[model samples]
Target: MNPINYLYLSALLFTIGGAGVLFRRNAIIVFMCVELMLNACNLAFVTFARLHGNLDGQIFAFFTMVVAAAEVVVGLAIIVTFFRSRHSASVDDASLMKL
Candidate 1:
């Protein structure tokens, strides 16, 4: 298939993820949408790397994956902690930063 098609799909996935992030109230759902956006970016990166016959985009994508993995670890920890304390995973319910 064409590289442009991959890019188009990536854009669509990113758009859907962005909309979910913006409209969703559930923390887990927002987190999932963020992951979806990251995966869309990774797809675009791999597609571009193949198109250009280079490893730069692939390297960037790898780093992104690494960061995302760390984010998942820490993010889930926080979410679980908040859920245990507040009993709700809604973003609006989190005012944990309140003084």
Candidate 2:
């Protein structure tokens, strides 16, 4: 596929993910949306790496995936804790920071 097609697909996925993050009230759904956005970015990075015949983009994408994996672990832990404390996974239900 062409670079433009890759970019368009990435942009579309990113937009959908952003909308989900913004519109969803559940914390778990928001986290999943964030993951979607990260994967979309990874797709874009790999596409550019192939188009330019460079290893840097692939390396960056690898690093991003690692970070995203770490984020998923940490985010899920927090979500689990929040659900335990609040008994609900809705973002609006957890306002401990607002105090």
Candidate 3:
């Protein structure tokens, strides 16, 4: 596939993920959106790495995946704790935690 095609596909996936994050009310869905966005970024990174004939972008993508994994663990812990305390997984309900 062409690099441009890969770039366009990555952009589309990222856009959809962004919309999901902005409009979704469910915490799990929001998390999934975040994952989608992260993967899209990884795709772009790999595409650029291949296009440039360099390992740096691929290494960056690897680090991004590692960070994303850590984020998932921490994010899920927070979500689980919030659900346990509030009994609702709705994003709006989470605002109550500010107080």
Candidate 4:
């Protein structure tokens, strides 16, 4: 398969995720969309690494996954805390948080 194809697929995934983040109101769905974007990036990274016959991109993707894991931990914690207080998980509600 051509590297350009992988790049196109990555762009498509990232665009879908961006649209989801922009249009979705639910916190969880938005979070998942962000994850989708990250995975799209990972896909591109791996494809390029393979094309170049090098491991650097794959290593970066590994670190990206680690960072994404940490993001999920902290993001879900905050979401859970907000839900506990408000009994909802809408991003609109989170915008009003003060202090």
Candidate 5:
């Protein structure tokens, strides 16, 4: 397996995630897409780490995963609150930030 293949896979995953974020109205789906993007990045990180014979990329991926976990916790809380108030998790309906 070539390292470039991993990069190609990562690119595909990122493209799909980006498209989902742009086109999906459901907050949960959008969130999952964002996670997909993050995992794609993680895959790239590990691939590069293996290629370079160093731990730096793996360390970065670990930190990224930690941050992503925290994001999931906070994002879900906000989404749940929005759903409770509006009875839906559509991104279009979350106008709480509007001035």
Candidate 6:
């Protein structure tokens, strides 16, 4: 398959993720969309690394994955805590957290 195909797929995934983050009402769905966007970025990084014949992009992707993993841990914990206190996981309801 052409490398360009990977880039196109990455772009599509990123776009979908962005739209989900923008339009989704559920907090969990938005979180998943953010993860999807991160994965799309990893894909693009790998593709660029392959095309350039260097490890820089791959290394950057590795670090990104590490950070993303940490984010998942913290983000899920917060989500669960919020869910336990609030009955719903709707993004609109998150505004109540300000209090």
Candidate 4 per-residue lDDT, tens place, 1-99, comes to 666999999999999999999999999999999999999999999999999999999999999999999999999999999999999999888766566
| Candidate 3 residue-wise lDDT, 1-99, digit = tens | 567999999999999999999999999999999999999999999999999999999999999999999999999999999899999888999674495
Q: Cα lDDT of model 2 overall? A: 0.94
Which residue pairs does candidate 2 place in steric collision? none
* Per-prediction TM-score to the true structure, in the order listed: 0.92, 0.94, 0.94, 0.94, 0.93, 0.91
Model 5 per-residue lDDT at 19? 97
**Candidate 2 versus the native: TM-score?**
0.94
TM-score of 5: 0.93
List the candidate 4 regions with Cα displacement exceeding 4 Å: 97-99
Compared with the true structure, model 6 gives a TM-score of: 0.91
Taking all chains together, the TM-score of candidate 3 against the true structure is: 0.94
Q: Give the Å error, residue 95, model 4.
A: 3.2
lDDT minimum window of 10 residues, candidate 4: 90-99
lDDT tens digits by residue: candidate 2, 1-99: 556999899999999999999999999999999999999999999989988999899999999999999999999999999889889999998777896
Tens-digit lDDT track of model 1 for 1-99: 666999999999999999999999999999999999999999999999999999999999999999999999999999999999999999999876888
lDDT of 6 by residue, 61-87 (tens): 999999999999999889898889997
* Error at 57, model 5, angstroms: 0.6
lDDT of 5 at 79: 94
Highest TM-score scorer: 3
Predicted candidate 6, C-alpha RMSD: 1.8
